[model samples]
Target chain A: MAAVDWGTTRLRVWLVDEAGNVLAERRGDDGLITAQAAGFSTILEGHLAAMGAPEAMPVIVCGMAGSRQGWLEAPYVTVPAPIGAILAGAARVPGQRRDIRIVPGLAQRQADAPDVMRGEETQLAGAGLPAKGRHLVCMPGTHSKWVLVEDSAVTGFGTWPTGELFSVLAAHSILRHSLGEQPQPVASGNPFFQRWCEQALAEGGDVTSRLFSIRAAGLLQDLKPGDAAACLSGLLIGGEIASASRRYGKGGSVVLVASGALSTLYTEALGLAGLAVRAVDADEAVRAGLIEAARKNGMIAGSGVAA
Target chain B: MAAVDWGTTRLRVWLVDEAGNVLAERRGDDGLITAQAAGFSTILEGHLAAMGAPEAMPVIVCGMAGSRQGWLEAPYVTVPAPIGAILAGAARVPGQRRDIRIVPGLAQRQADAPDVMRGEETQLAGAGLPAKGRHLVCMPGTHSKWVLVEDSAVTGFGTWPTGELFSVLAAHSILRHSLGEQPQPVASGNPFFQRWCEQALAEGGDVTSRLFSIRAAGLLQDLKPGDAAACLSGLLIGGEIASASRRYGKGGSVVLVASGALSTLYTEALGLAGLAVRAVDADEAVRAGLIEAARKNGMIAGSGVAA
Candidate 1:
């Protein structure tokens, strides 16, 4: 069996043995945006061939590939929904050479606070839902998701455009003058980043006002470009945590599903925000989720009965 | 005499008679950013000549023209300081054909909440500081200033990057997909705008999270381009007002120093937030500010003592 996490800008695939051990893996730039124009089936076949996967191997997919503009629309499953239900509601690609199932995303249709998530749902499932007590999950990315899980069900969730906002402001806004043209990675241990995180957490609600302080600090206090970049990251991540904590209720421990640089930054920020976080590798979680979905759909042999 | 508002992206010069009445006006794209390389003196001279001003006319300039990168660094007048003191601290351009004075901006030097504003001080001086009472002034622009004025002095203020955020998000972020290429002015009475404004005011502090909803709403509810644009505007403005009101204390009536479309949008949003707003034309206020600065500096004859 094979698993794939296909998003807007990147694609990751893994070939797994019957016991769910990863035998091989491959990554590509052929995300939904690129693959949509140049055939999804072709892209998937090429990637599978590159990984040397068998032609009859069953594949499980997640993320934007199931979006309306992708190969086929996998309509959103509304919350308070069980994570396992996503696998049960998976949409299979029609007229395919092999069995390919795409996990459905989640939607919060509350009129006042409507939100949707594509790839993060799989991350949540892979993180393992809390069985007895409620849990708060923070998945940081281009669109960060704050999920509330109670007794293995996702009660509600919110999305924060922190990453996107930071990118756009750092590149396009006047703050770009302070933050140089090149995208510099903010160091998690930078004091400037820590100070800004504390400041943002303290001034929780006034993000817009605090954002201007970056420029003011740059202009008036001679804040260095690298520090400015770190400050920006801290402020955005800290503010997201503050707001998410408030909105979702900060009662339980937060499960942070992330990887690489983002994971480090978010872990530091959550710690600064004074929350205990259980870290999970996002890549592994997504793959585990795909494997679980495949097993539930009977595309792969498993003893578990439809989750 | 002439009054000039030389900002980063625009230049506006108004020829005024001794009685403080505008005789002629000229506007150009050569702001401090553009004029810095093009020669500030040459640009000013051309505008003055276009407005048919006399060679000996003393010009009172405000805004970015006073920045370090401007004609000459006017330096910052620290607060809690009187607005009229700006005239006294003005930086004069030496070795020029005409007497050109640039009013200094105000800076809050506090290490925790450092903030700075250039042109708005002149507007405050022109608007005539509240006599024997406290006033909250909202100057909406690229960097909107929410100033707290008491007994003719600016005690403290905050800057919200609402306008810049809106522009960047509308033009560069994922929201741009729904908002089209050309920026559309949000209608004040748009229901989507009003609803989002009310929601933002209610939610108040979660701007980053709410921003993502704009994209989600567009995706799930099929929100149109115009409505999406309006919704974005409402969320930003409402969030700004909410945070500003909280930080500045929502006791006094808000003095909305804005003009045209922004004024209308702000006024309506403020009204929705259940705050009484005293609308002051921003153009007239800035002009009056420049005129007052000129008079106080003894460049023009006036009987009125500096407020």
Candidate 2:
């Protein structure tokens, strides 16, 4: 059996043996957007062939591939929904050469704060649903998702476009003048970064007003370009934490599902916000989620073989 | 005498007689940024000459022309400072054919909420300081300044980059997909705009999270492109108002210093927030500011002659 996590800009695939041990893996630039134009079936076949996947090997897919504009729309399953229901309600691609199932996303249809998520649902499932108590899960990315899980069910969630907003502002807005032409990486240990996060958490609200201070600090206080970049990151991430904590009480243990630099930065920020974090590598979690889907559908054996 | 309002992207010059009568007026695209390359003196001279002003005619200039990067740095006059200090601390262009003076901007040097504003201080002076009372002045623009004037002195102010944020998100971010190619104008009367403003004011914080809803509403609710644009405007402006009101306190006579479309939109949003607005034309206010500067310096007589 094979598992795939297809998003807007990238694609990752894992080939597993009958016992669910990873035999091979592949990654490509053919995400849902590119795949839609290049032919989703063709792209999938090319990737599978590159990984030497068998013709009859069933594939379990997740993410934007199930969006309305993707290969086929996998309608959203509304919350407070059980995580396992995503696999149960998976949409099977029709008229395919090989068996392929796409996991459904979760939607919050509350009229005042309507929201939807695609790929993050799988991450949540892979993180393991908390069966006994309420848990706060933070998934940071282009669109960061702060989700609430209670007794294996996702009660509600909020999406923050922190990464996307930071990118756009850093590249195109006047804030770019403060942050130099080259993209600057925000490290957790940077004091400027830590200070900004602390300030944001302390300030509590007036985020838009605080955003202008990044530029002002640069102009008036001679803030370094690298520090400006870090400050921007800290302010955005800090605002996300503050807002999410306010909306969803910040008492529970936080499960941070992230990878690479983002994981480190978020871990540090959550610590500053006075919350203990349980870190989970996003890559492994997504693969685990895909394997879970395949196992539930009897495509892959539940027991795993030694690598 | 002549009055000039030279900002980043546009330049407006008014030729006035000694009695402060507008004899002729000219507008050009030679703003501070462009004028830096085109020669500020040449641009100012051409506009003055186009209106057939004498080379000896004294000119009172305001806005970005006084910044450190401009033709001559006027330096910032720090606040809890009187608006009249802007005129007294004006920077004069040396070695020029005409006597050109640029009004200095006001800077709030508070460690936590440091901010600076150029061009708007002249408008405040022109608007006439509120006598023996606290006035909340909302100056809406690319960098909107919500100034607190207590008994004719600027106690403090907050700058919200609402307009710039809106432009960048609508043009460069994923939110652009929901908003059409051509930039849509957000009318004051748009119900979609009104609802978003009300919602933003009601849900006072967590602005970054609310921004994501614009995209979600479009995806799930099939929000129209025009309404999406309006909602974006409402969300930003509403967020600015909410944050500013929180920082400055909502009580007081709210003076909205704006003109044309922005004036209408802000006035409507303020009204929805249950604050009665005193609308002041931004154009007239700036002109009044420049005129006040000229009159205070004895360049133009205090009394004005009707055109």
Candidate 3:
């Protein structure tokens, strides 16, 4: 069986043996845009062939490939949708010789706060959350999602444009002058980052009033561009944590599904807000999710079930 | 007498008679950058000459011209310094034929929330708030400043980058796709704007969580580009109001120093937040401020004072 995470800008695939051990792996920029232009079948099959994958190995796909503009629209399964329902709701790509199923994303259609997520749902399914009780899951990205799950069902979630806001403000806003062209990396331990994060949390996530202070600090105190960048990162991330905490309550540990730099930042921010972090690698979670979808869709045999 | 508002990217000069009536006006792109290249004296003299003003007429300048990088560094008068200090601290631009002065800006150097304002201090002086009470002055612009005035002294102020945030998000963020290249103007009566503003206020200015919903709503509900732009505006303005209210308490009517489209939008948002707005035209306020600076510096005689 082959598991593929086909997002908007990147694609990754892994071949697994019957025992669930990885046999081969491939990654590329052949995401939705490339696949749409080159043809999804051409791209997928080419990658499979290059990895020397078996001709009959069915593929379990997720992410933007399931979006309306992608290869085939895997219509969203609205929440409080059961975890198993998502795996079962896989939309099979028609006319393909091999069984190719794309996992459906989740949609919250609340009138006031309509939201939809494609790839992150697969990551959620693979996060291996507890079967019972309420859990708060934090998935930080360009658009971060704070999801609430109860009894293995997604109850509700909120999305924050923290990452995108930071990008735009740094690159395009007046703060650009203070931040310089390319800002230095902001580590979790950066004092400026921690302090600003704490301040945002203390102020109940009201950061707009404090943003201009960064530029002023640069002008008046000669604050370094690197520190200014760190302050921004802290303010945004801190604001996100504060809002999510208020919306969903600071309940125990947050299942932080992220990797690398973002992971470090969020972990630090969450801890500052008095929330413990249960870290999970995003890549592993998505792959596990695809594998689960494959098994549930009967493309692969469950461990205790007969093939 | 000549009053000049020399900001970062714009320069405006008003020729005023002894009676404080404008005789003529000249506006140009001779701001800090241009003035730096083509000597400030030359730019001022050229504008003055074009206005047919007397060669010996004294000039009173404000805004970025007072900054260290400007023509003459009119060092910031630290708060809670009285309005009189700012007027008296005017830095004289030496080596000029005329007695040219630049009004000093106000600086809040509290290590935790350091802030500075150049042109706005003049506006505050001209706003004509009650001399005894603690007044909250809301000046909306690219970097919107909410100032606290007690007696004739500026206690403190905070700057919210509301306009700049809206501009960058519309032009550079993923929301740009939903908002279009050029969104229709968002008026005060836009329902989408009102609703989002109300929501942000209710949520205690926690708008970071709601930011992505604008993008999601566009994807799911086929929200119009104009409505999307309105939603962004509402969220930012609403958040600013909410935060400022928390920081400075929703006291009596807020002194709203703004004009044009911004004045309309802010007036509506402030009403939604249940605060009365004492509307003041920004142009008139700044001009009045410059006049006040001129009178205090004796470049122009006070109505009651001897020449």
Candidate 4:
């Protein structure tokens, strides 16, 4: 069986043996936008062939490929939906020789604050959250999600534009003058990052009002570009955590599904916001989720094994 | 005498009589960035020349022309300082035949929340708030300032990147896909604007969390580009107003120092947030400020007449 995560701008594939051990792996920039133009089946079959996948092997996919604009529209499973509903709602691609299914996303259908997530749903499914208890899962990315789960079912969630806001402000806003041509990487240890993160949390997530201070500090106090960048990053991430904590109520520990830089930043920020964090690698979670979907959909044998 | 409002990206010059009545006017895009390379004196003289000003005629300038990177570095007057201090601290351009002076901006030097305003301080000087009582002035722009003025003195202020944030998010973020290439004009009457404004105020200004809803609404509900843009605008402005009202408190009426579209939007948002608005034209305020500075510096006689 093969598992694929096809997002808006990235694609990853992993081949698994019947025992759920990885046999081969492939990654590419041929995401929804590119694959839509070049053709999804063409791209998927190429990767499968390059990995020497069997002609009749089944494939499970998640992410933007399941969106309305992607290869197949896997209709959203609205919360408070059971995790099993996601596997059951998988949309099978028509006219494909191999059995290929795309996992459906989750949607919050409230009129005032509607939201939908594609790829992250699969990650949530694979996070191995306690099925019998309430849980809060934090998946930080371009659109970070703070999800509420209870008894293996998603109850509610909110998305924060933390990463996207940081990117646009750093590149297009007047703060760019203070941040310089290329912003420096923000580390968890940077004092400015820690300070602004604490400040934003203290202020109850009122961050827009403090944004201009970065530009002013650069002008009045000669704040370095790197420090300014770190400050911006901290404020955005801190604001996200502060708002999320307020909305979700900081529980004992949040399940943080992230990897690399975002994971480090969120870990530091959530700690500053007074929450313990349980770590989960996003890549592994999604692969596990796809594998689980494959087994549930009868594409793979129901072996009592965890990937 | 010539009164010039030279900012980072714009230049406005008005030739005024001793009575402070504008005799001729010239506007150009030769702002700080352009003038820095073309020579500030050269651009000033060209505008002055077009307006038919005498070579020896004195000029009173405000805004970025007085910044460290401008024609001359007019050192900031730290607040709580009187409006007169801005006029008193004007920096004269050296080695120029014309007796040109640039009014100094006001700065709040608190280490925890340092803030500075270059162009808006000049507008504050001319906003004409009651000199005997405390007042909150909202100056909407690329960087919106909610200034606390008392007895003709500026005590403190907070700058919110409301306008800039709107621009960046609309142009560079995933929201751009929701908001079309050229987003339709967002009027104050747009229900999305009114709803989001009230919502942000109700949510205590935690707007970063709601930012993704604009994107999601587009994906799930097929929100039109214009409405999405309006929602973004409302959230940013409402968040700014909410956070500002929290810090400054909702007083009787906010002195709204703005004009055009911003004037309309802020007026609407502020009203929704439970504050009556007293509107002022930003152009008139800046000109009045420059004229006031000119008279204080003796470039123009202290005429009893007001412009």
Candidate 5:
């Protein structure tokens, strides 16, 4: 019995019987970056031993570790490449002790355009939700990925590091002094926040004048630091959404893969845009994706699979 | 006689006699970032010795080196802080046998709306050629500084790291593949460039959709990488200028302190906004700022007095 999901920062594993009954499971800090540096076998050995899984256990690996820079370079499925095709192309870890297979990524090139994505390939396939129409999927994070899916395939997609930029700006800019240690305000549609977004959107935002407003409103006008940071967050996220709409907006369906406060923030903001937002649980999607990958590789029965 | 201009990147010393006649000069790489780590005296020694100047020679400094992180921390001059004031508040390097004075920067504030500047003080002094009405001076670079002044006194200002942002986005993002090199083909005002900017401004980009265009335009539509990069540059700079107008656009003046391609770029863009443009040589301004600073502190002669 085996289950595993690997990302840039965390390593997760699960113990399951042939009937997919979870008797035990374990987790550790075996990320792709570390696994690449420390032998993947050694790290996996420590964790598997903890889970009481034997060396001969069959395990499925996904995420960043499946990339070229990963422990074992999994091949990429080019853009316009089908999700099912990528799942079928999973790479097997060449070791006699353990049965491990790494899922391949996806890529596409049409006309002169080209893009490639790795782990998302499996997640999109495992979504278990049928794709009958055009789908606009927004995956928010450091490098936020927005994908367009049609005919159960990833036709094309774009990525934005909205999360990374937001983090950096919040920490480094003048806004930092005002926004010190406060949680991002909960009011997604706060008036000051909307106004700030409109102001930046209006300026095409070389972002100079409106930025001074951040300091001015705080120093003279007495705008709260949390509100100011929230306002700035609004501008950045708003700017990103505005820029992205040009592409994926053409799609008729919208699904947002997010969780926690971020999901609330994005969904509330999107509500303002008059779009019906369907929020997906991030953790569930990760598991659903892994299970589907294992089934496609013949490691599990596709019939009545449970995640 | 001594004349030197220390900018962010290069150290240029003009060895001169009392008449401002050149005896000999030397050039070296000693931007603030580099000098911040290697002590200021080491950076100064190389130049002074190169010019055959004695350790006791009185050398004045201006620009960023006079900032808090510079060779010595020259204090910040508050808004409405005049050019002469910065010189008067110059900070001297201690322990060196040589007499050294660093010019102070300018500042602006409205109640708690306080912002300060350093290098532009000298640029305005050097451009002493005109101050007829309200004018706007823009110094474009990694951190492009826009200084608004009236009757020769700095009124208010803002900073836009357009160049720096452009550098980071183009060099780091997937967009980098398209932005082959600088001086890209898509001029800021071109139809495609304008459309891209307008869309981003109007729509409020989504991370996925906003960034996807770079790949899409190049991948799906067959747009060139350089042109793509240029379009991105135009969008950012245009957005910045647009943002700046909202704050400082209310009937003042316009001047620019920059050189090379950057100056031309900002000048053309700002021209699109109908603001009058003029430029002050950063190198010369640093020299003049230094001289002015020395005199304010009794290091150099007053206007009529000789060294």
Candidate 6:
């Protein structure tokens, strides 16, 4: 069984033998912006050519590459379903010369607060428990998703444009006057950040107003440039925390699907919002979900489902 | 006396003849960015060339062009007064043959709000007053300023970076994702804009959340992109109006310093704020202020100040 998680910026392909044992894996750029989708075909071909060809090898793919703009349009599955219901929802990707299947992205409520899952459904199936829970799975990125899992079913979820806002404001806003150009990691105990958090918590001030303080702080010697950028970062993330708390916040076992250094920052913010943090490997979840999808569809040997 | 108003992006030099006439004028690229004092040589030379003069002229200069980065490092005069106490502040470009004088900017701190103004002092001086009634001046631009005029002097002011913020978000933010790359005018009285206004008024609702709605509104068939853009503009301006009300609402006489299209927008927003819109010609204000500054220093002959 082979599962591929192809996201905007990165691509990872995993291979499992008949026993579901991980035999090999490869990672490459899947962002497709520069390499185009040609890169994905080349990587898969190289690995298959090196591993020696099997009689039949079925592949399951997911992520942006599955969208209308991706390698092919993968039909989206609506929300509120048991584990197996949506698997039947994926549209087949008719690769010209390769046996390939793509996972469908999900959308709800006309895309306002739409939640999406590219290749993560297989992992949910493997979790075994009913998707039913007051469960909220947070996948943070340029567009952060908060998926509500209930009774082994994919219920409603909210997608906040928080990540994109942070990216643009940090890199492009006039706050850059004080922040300079590059991003600087924020100190954990910075007073400016503390002021930002407390002030936002107390007054729920507009983020724009809060951002202006970066320039003001620098001018008043209240904050240095690096610290000003960090403080702005804190303000943005802190606002995200506050916003998410109110949006996808109802009861549930909160799951944070995070990667890299951002995990700690997000966890800390969640804690600040009084949320108990439990981390999940986002890569593993999506990878696992894709594998189960392949096995369930009989594209891979059923005995290899455990892989 | 000759006065130069050096702004951030452009160097504006007016030749206030001894009779207080703009005998000749010249403009050049930003005086600050070029590292050369356009305020001194090129501008003076241009004026001299235009008027066919070989003698030096006394001038008064203001704006960012006169700041530390400008041709002259004009000191920031504190508020509640019309003119800086210092003599032309620090002249960076002391031309060997030109008798040039630069007007200083203003810096003020009132309780917790601190503000710095450049080039506006010229207008305040031109608006000769009894020093008792309040005059609220709203200067809308990349970084909008709402100045509180008290007794002929600027008591304090609050800065709302609505223009810059709008520009950055519309051009760079994730909001750009939903909007096509093409630039378009915003639709007035559009539903998207109305939604933005509602969001702006929402308790704790930040602009970031409303930003994504641009895409959502346009993509989902309910809102036009132009209208979505307009809503964003409206939301930002609305938010600014709210902030300004809190900071400088004590005034009975509110004055708006804008002209042309921006003036109309500002007028619409002021109407939304339930304030009587009184438009002041910005160019005339600058001229009046320059003339008054020249007259006060006995450099030019007439009052020539208009309200």
Residue-pair clashes per candidate: 0, 0, 0, 0, 43, 28
Residue B199 CA displacement from its true place in model 5, Å: 13
Compute the lDDT for candidate 6: 0.63
Candidate 3 per-residue lDDT, tens place, B1-307, comes to: 9999999899999999887799998899989989889988898899999999897999999999888889989898888877766776788888888989999998898888989999999988888887788889999988899999888889999998888888888889888998999987798699999999999988777778888899889888889999999999999999999989998997467999998999999999999999988999988888888888888877788832211
Docking class for candidate 6: acceptable
TM-score of model number 5, chain B: 0.82
**Which structure among the candidates has the greatest TM-score?**
1
**What's the residue-level lDDT of B154 in candidate 2?**
92
Q: Of models 1 and 5, which has the larger lDDT?
A: 1
Clash-forming residue pairs, model 4: none
Better of 4 and 5 by DockQ: 4
Model 6 chain B: lowest-lDDT 10 consecutive positions: B82-91
Candidate 3 chain B, run of 10 with poorest lDDT: B298-307
Error of 2 at A99 (Å): 0.9
Give the alpha carbon lDDT tens digit for every residue of A42-134 in model 2: 999999999899899899999999998898889999988878776667788999989898988988888878899998989888887557788
RMSD of 4: 2.5
lDDT of 3 at B136: 94
Candidate 3 lDDT (Cα, 0 to 1): 0.88
The segments of candidate 2 whose C-alpha lies over 4 angstroms from its true place after superposition are A303-307, B302-307
For candidate 4 chain B, the 10 contiguous residues with the lowest summed lDDT are B298-307
Query: In model 4, what lDDT does residue A209 have?
Result: 79
Q: Give the winner by TM-score: 1 or 4.
A: 1
Poorly placed runs, candidate 3 (over 4 Å): A303-307, B303-307
TM-scores of all predicted structures: 0.97, 0.96, 0.96, 0.96, 0.66, 0.80
Expressed as tens digits, the lDDT of each residue in A1-307 for candidate 4 is 9999999999999998777688899999999999989999999999999999999989999999998889999999888888877776788899999999999999998888899888898898889898799899999988899899999889999998788788788888888899999997797688999999999998777898789899889877889999999999989888988888888885478999999988898899889888888999998899888888887777888842212
Native-to-model Cα distance after best TM-score fit, residue B267 in candidate 1, in Å: 0.7
